[model samples]
Target: MPIISKQHGNTLLITLVILILFSILGLSLLSISISGMSKNEIREDNIQSQDLSEKGIDRITHQINSELTKKIEENNGLTRTNFINLLNSTVNKYKCTSGGSIADSNGKTGSYNACIKEVNPTFEKNKPTVENELRKSIVFESKGKSGDSTKILLTEIEIGAESAPETLKYAVGTNINDKDGIQDGEGNLYLHGGVSVKGDFKVDGNIITRNFGYAYLNGEQWIQSLLPESIPSDGSTNSKLVLGKDSYRLTTNTGYNNHIDRNTFTGSTYSRTTDMKNLFSGEKVPKIVQRDPVISPIGITDQKANFFLISGEYYSTGVNKIPISNVNKSSSKIIPTYTERTRECVRGFLICFEYKNVDTEKESGSFEMNGTNRFNQFSTIGSLELTNSNSTFTKGLYVGGNLQIGNNNTTYNSNNYSDITLDGPIYVKGNVNIQGANLKSNVLLYVEGEVKIQYSTINGKPLTDGKQGSLIIFSKGQIKISNNSVNQDNPSQIKGFFYSEQDLEIYGVGSNIRIEGGISARRIVLNAIRGRASDKLFTGATKINSNDYFEGEVGQKTRESRLQIIYDQEIIETFSNLKQPEPIIYKVEPPLVKERKI
Candidate 1:
């Protein structure tokens, strides 16, 4: 009996061991299955999130582009409110909870909170969380949790071509480099609207901006503000515009106001005063002691007519001298002792005039003014020629489109109260003459073709008042401003002349450049015209200060008054520091994405 019991016990033990082994194998198989399922669900969720994020970006981009195009077409500037409204209108995000959901789609759900915050709305906010929200509606939120049986599905609907809403939607963000550092590549940046740069920046593409355009010297609040309110400490350490120092030049390697010997600088690089007048038409300066300050009053007659202007105030005397206020300054001083003196707006000057004879001027058509009653005026086309002839402008030439001039001696005239504003590019192909005492706005002179001045001059007569304004003359081709004829405005404000914010590009090797007026360009190609070199005897006596001169920083009160920075693709995609996850592409496209229910 004992032997039998022992054998039975052995058999039972073997059975128990076998059962334990099978249980272990079964558990392992179950674990593998669960892991595979979880991975599949995770992949699906990521695809949906990515799609939704892309859709959000698309909607935002469309709004930006549309707003910019409209602003340009209407000849108006863009505002922050405009951007915010567009964002809110384009995409409405609500919480996924039943109480928060709005326009919910599929089973995928989420929530959104208005991310618009306010700093100095006038200036570019520092990594503005609010602005970013408006620009990019989807802020990344991670998806992870404690152990549990949970599956999430996200759907995003991008406005793609042939897919419901036909919008050109492109995803832009940082891509991780194999070396780990993020690359600010163009591919990652998206340019939907016009972008401007207010600070000194190194870019990889052509930049275009309009109305109150300028580039700042640095990317800092204090630098942009130019006021102690931003940086209470010594403000002199801030970067200011230097003509020749700091190895600065109008164009790369091409010195500022330097003599071009072979389209390259030969003599010492200098910003000559004569070059200043040539680039910008105005009166000659008085030779004075270096660092001497001078202030001259401007004359004005009318009170009903309103006038505003932008001018430079030089605190120094003579040429190439630092400002007097900058003498013996620490590293934090804005500028050293002064060398030259220039100021604008001696008095408020208004531009207003009337022309009674219209039938004689417009023989072919009738044009309507925006505010005034119907009156016929002399046509500006082919009517006035400067063979030493007196020409008068009857009305303010307000431009809604571009103006192009052909090869011919055409005299452009404006009365003491008349002004000409090139809201768009003004292409001149022949010898063009301009005369006006009160220029309230700016003039764009682009000579893509030959331009010859028959002893013409831009002289600001009635020089008793020592005020002048600014001007810009740009030529992509041959140009010569050598006529003795005068072109000058009344001395009432510091005037800016021929200050192009764009890099000058010339194709022809025979292109010659000669300017008796102020000339500002991104670049200058003296050899664009091969034989035109000798013809280009750019002779003038005015000093040229290329690059926008820095004025410490404007206070918060003048944030919108100055040029604003452009948020181009490079700025968006290449912004320093902010890192985003790599775009997760999917094998199977996710379902259409919709805003979460509010």
Candidate 2:
């Protein structure tokens, strides 16, 4: 009985040890299962965070593309401020919760924020490069967080260059869509007498030709010409001109038997046949549109005016003129000096004129020539008439009304002591009558009304010499050059860019007219033919006809007039930096993801 008792005790001890081993094994298995579950959760969270980050980037990109499409359709450009506003608005749409957390549609709780890192733009020759060559890149970064997982995405977007405004691209452009033929007839563009254009020629309506009426273009010529009697099929000798939805007309009332130098007519000519549509499917009529800038007037006080002349109305009679000693001084109130302020005000406005109605009889003023005077920039709300004045304008001039330089028979001769130098641009809202004056190099004149140049000298020296100058004249109305002649001794001669929205007429009995610039107009008329011997020089029919008859015989002794215009390629840059179209997002970089342990 004692031996059996001892063996039972031993067996009980072994059983207890086995039970302990089993408990240890069970605890180890439980721990392994929990570890696997935790790892799986971590992996799923990481994926969710990554997907949230990618979705955030995609959403921002879509928003940007949509906005850009709208801007492009509206012909608007995206500025830096506009881009920042877009990002801020997008962030607000995907608002986070009170604890700075939000759940996506996929039921994953995460937070995302985006910011702009950089915006860089590249330029060429001081002008924006072509769309393909333009370099405008932006960097965007997005961060997303979900539970203990966080993901970051970085992206880069390249924006395409903005195209130039159509109005600025053409040497002569108008927005007249004269459905009725009345306005169209008066607004017809005319070309004649060795006229040349260095850039494209665009007109909104019909085009008319006068005697020897031909336009020489270094670029393209877009005209809505009248259709010919019969259209020709494709032939080597056949006219390369295509019939559009418009018609063409000759000044002589003749047919389309006009001659064009092969070298000058490198571009295709299109005319409209019916209903203002191109007969040839591939032919296109370049349209001329209008664009106006916002006018914000700057306010001036007595103190400000004392430093720089700023006035709503300016009048000078006799030998009185605005003195130049007052300009570019220090202002007592403004933080910046008056010179700095004046530069800032006029820097954006090379030329500016605002039209305002004034009593011509009461407000008409003139500046008489007496002594030499200097001015930085001059602007007026009314007409500006200069009579025998020797003035030097260093910057620019703007007149709300007419700009008359000299009177009839008043010769403007520049001597060593007495000279008039217009160094910058001139803007006139009304008529421009320049009887005799000397325009320095790189001078530009823009008129909103009629332009009459009786006698003038442009660029008193040759282009080879550093003293040579260039001139550009733009007119919204008719342009008439009567009895005008260039300098005889100057190699630079008269280089002029004469552009008219309406008719460009040149009338001379025997005087020689030589212009080294270009001429772009709606209708160009040249009446250089000598007056008939039998015809009376003076006509007694009407008042308007009497002046024409008197001036007719004044230049009759010469018997012939020589008109020449040679296109200059250097003036092309003068019209650069105009308004441009909106930019486009061309390329988008793939989103880069980075995981962070939180």
My TM-score estimates for the predictions, one after another, are 0.30, 0.45
Which window of 10 residues has the lowest lDDT sum in candidate 2?
294-303
Q: Give the Å shift of residue 60 in candidate 2.
A: 9.6
**Cα miss at 452, model 1 (Å)?**
3.1
In Å, residue 225's CA in model 2 sits off its true spot by 22
| Candidate topping lDDT | 2
> Model 2: residues >4 Å from true position, as ranges?
1-118, 124-175, 178-182, 193-199, 207-364, 369-371, 380-382, 387-390, 410-419, 460-468, 486-496, 499-501, 506-572, 576-598
lDDT of each: 0.25, 0.43
Off by over 4 Å in 1: 1-8, 28-32, 39-43, 63-430, 433-450, 453-469, 474-478, 481-598
The sequence of per-residue lDDT tens digits that candidate 2 reaches over residues 1-598 is: 8999999999999999999998898889889889988988888778777777766666665665565546534633344344445534433343332132222444446666655444444354444563223334545556766778888766665543322223333333333433333342343444432232223344444443333322112322221222111112223122122211134423333322232111122123432233322321112322333434211111111111222224332222222232222223121111111122233335444222223333332322332322444455555545666644544444446565687765444432333112244444566767888766554445566677798876564453233445455566767677877644422222225655666666676633223454554565545444332222111244321112222221133332332224444444444443331101222222222322222222
Return the number of clashes found in candidate 1. Answer: 98
